[model samples]
Target: MPEAKETVLEIDLGALAHNYRYLRAKIDDGVKFLSVVKAFAYGNDSVIIARKLEELGTDYFAVAYVEEGIHLRKNGITKPILVLHPQFTHFEDIIEHCLEPNLYSEKILRSFVETAEAKNQKNYPVHIKLNTGLNRLGFDHPEIGTVKEIISSTSSLKIASVFSHLAASEDWKERDFTVGQIDLFRKMTWELIADLDYEPILHICNTSGVINYPKSAFSMVRSGIGLYGYGNDKNIDPELRPISTLKTIISQIRSLDKGDTVGYNRAFKVEKPTRIATLPLGHADGINRIYGKGKAGVFINGQYAPIAGNVCMDIIMVDVTNISCEEGDEVIVFGGPQHPVKFAEAGGTISYELITGIQRRVSRLVIPE
Candidate 1:
């Protein structure tokens, strides 16, 4: 990859392919793989990532909203795209873009059915989300009959898949809870599918679920962070490579004398004479303010330089006292020797939040396979 002159997010499609194959190998041959390309493909270039995944023969793609699915369709993505959280207002647009909506509620289901009927659509694909253990989205067990009644009442809509989200599949401590979720999903989906004219794909595994729960690999599986190169498990992380590298360069170097303070509110007081390097990216660029005050560091010339003080809107000062670095030296914010998980841990966050929080302003360079 080319050296970074300014802050940039380098996306490696080769690594993405590797991760896809790794996850694909974990499931059965017939099981379909749904790549979750939501949140701008988790803050990378969605169009580029989706294009590559589509080329790799991903069975389906998933996004958080209708606009994201529309963006993918506009970018020539031909595969089926699942809109996980569709709103009533965007139901028409979702159908217009050939995107499937996850009908998680009665209101959404009825609204989408009405919209599809209005459009004179027949057998429109839609996903059913069931709330097993994760209480965030999806219909509860009590609503399964109502969901079926609504589906029965509409010819404009068809259930393409019935799926649920795993809340703690990665945590072994929550094994019982995870298994219970899987069992509950299976029971609910089976009950719902018993009377249907056709079989809908049943799935409930996320990346971690794919790794830990092979038995629950129903008909299809969804992977988000794992494809971007995170398995959410230490044992599996090494087997996959992170696809995005957040890189920046040392814009300037400052020599601080004893008793000198740096950044807003004088967060960092120089106990001894030190050299600090100012980077061209900061909180606005996705390096959250919680990573400030020596909480996190960037890799400079193979050595780690801790963030000196508070993270500003467009800049950050790192203590490069011990590192032999100068202005314009490539600094790895994450996705180098240190994984994004490390940086996220420093701020009490996760790789998902850290990566997805990356702003759209950062330039992206794709490394093709």
Candidate 2:
């Protein structure tokens, strides 16, 4: 275990396990669980996170693209990897790497079937995405006939699972919509099952869906943000522990007199003798530029050091005028005493964006459980 002396992301596998168990407890014992490790496990090292989840008995893992799954496979991940939005060009790679393709449209379905047939694959596993309401991807309920036709026409493909995404499972106001989505999913899945005479694993719930609609857990559920320790609901947030801490060491602390300007464009003007601490990271490291101009603060010496002026590509200055801090002091941009959700809210964004936006250049240290 090494201290974060520079800009680093400290990932706590202990807290990740706690979140996994916590979410798992919400569903039935027999239900399967899929942990999403896409976007580098939401910017926390995909291979490491998947390994930890695999150790905890995660039934499946999902990534947004084929390369991510291939990366996991290359790193010794043997569990089923679902490419949620795979491209037709990568169908060969998907097969060669044993990564499951999510057939969301007729074109993808037919194309993947052809690729599998060419590769001499038999009963190759594939997940079907249904467009219940999100409308982003997946085939519409009416397209089930086409979906069935495509599958029946090819012996090379097998339906591993049928799933959909909830539009707004976290908001109480959208509860009715979420329920409608769930009901539609149930109706579509059973209808498809009736025609096929065999039931593949059925799932539609995400993190919030698992919490708000446990009864609709189906055969399996997907946990994305929740596994990273965010419930996405205020009431349930207290139970989950944040797993990542973003820390950076102050490069220098400079004194500024009244009327002195700080940072680019003179965005922050000192009213009195102020101490400005410059950090070695900024928007390039995923601290969004929107967080500047006093909107977000970093934790230092048990105090808040407000951001001063505009965020730079590789630097940011924070006003630590009133705090007792020196050069090389550890600053917590997010996590530990401060949560990323707070920073997200301050920046008018979401935690998913804030966390996943973290650049790969930053070191990710896994904290022992």
Candidate 3:
């Protein structure tokens, strides 16, 4: 590895493949695997991660926007890319890039069809998103009739797939809700298929949905965080490897007396003699201030050093008194076997927030296979 930088996110493609294979094992051999590479592949460099997954034989790729799909297309990604939340304004670009848009509303559906027609395109692939339980996006069950009517009337558009999002696939207590979602998804898609002359692929399983409801894997399953080495369930997490590690080096070390304070607002006061190590990472680097006040810790020389004081925009101080570390010693915020879930849990959040919140400014080092 090159000399330690101020801070870096080390991405291990090998671990990513491991997670993909593990998730693949849960489904039947014929079920297609769709890797969600949106949000920069959950902030792990979508282009790099997508390339690897492409080589690994992913059946499809998904992103949150049309531009994200365009980015992949620009970088030579030819596999079918799904724009999960496409905007009407980008329908032309979506067609230009050969990216499938997830049509969830009447306006978007009509707009995309008109745009495709104006562009002289025919039978452009599109996915329909149903509002099963996550009211955030997708059309309601009643609107399915309107959706079918619009698609049936359009020669410019074709339904490539039908899917929905699960609101709580990870929580066993919400098993009933998930089951309801699965049932509704199946019913809605089946009805839509029966109404149409041709059948499109159907899917609704996200990462957690894939693990907890494998039987609901209809035609294809989308794995987002799970492919990045998190199952959203503790029992299954051990089988996956975290693909990204946020590491930084200590910039300086300070000794504080019993009365001395650290960081802005003196959020942390030295109750006893303490040693603090300042690192070149802070909220600006995706370490939220909520992780301050000893809520989060970083791994240094095999020992966990708790955060001491408020997190600044460009720096943070850690209580490294008991750790055997020096200036420039590498400190791991989260990654590999340590897992970001622990950090998220300690900070009153989830792993998704930690990983996706990582700023694009942070350097990402991709590990060779």
Write model 1 residue lDDT over 1-369, tens digit each, in one string: 899988899999999999999999999999999999999999999999999998898999999999999998998999999999988889879978899999998888888888999999999999999999788998999999999898998889889999999999999999999999998998999889899989999999999999999878999999999999998888998999999999999999989999999999999999999999999998899998999999999999999999988999999999999999989899999988889999899988899899998999999999999
The predicted structure with the larger TM-score, 1 or 3, is 1
How many clashes show up per model?
0, 0, 0
TM-score of each: 0.98, 0.98, 0.96
RMSD (Å) per prediction: 1.0, 1.1, 1.4
User: Which of 1 and 2 is ahead in lDDT?
Assistant: 1
Reference-based lDDT, residue 22, model 2: 96
Q: Report the C-alpha lDDT of model 2 over 1-369, residue by residue, as the tens digit.
A: 454698999999999999999999999989999999999999999999999999999999999999999999999999999999999889999999999999998888888888899999999999999999999999898888888878888889889999999999999999899999999998988877676756799999999999999999999999999999999988888999889999999999999999999878899988999999999998999997899999998999779988999999999999998999889888999997788899889989999999999998998888978
Q: What tens-digit string does per-residue lDDT give for candidate 3 at 1-369?
A: 554567999899999999999999999889999999999999899999999999999999999998899999999998999998898788778877899999888898888888888888888898989999999989999987888788888788888899999999999999999999999988888878786788788899988988888998989999999998888888998999989999999999999999999989989999899999999989998999989999988999889899998999999999998988899898889974367999989899999899999998899998977
Residue 263: error of model 1 in Å? 1.1
Rank the candidate models, highest lDDT first.
1, 2, 3
Q: Which stretches of candidate 1 lie over 4 Å from their true place?
A: none
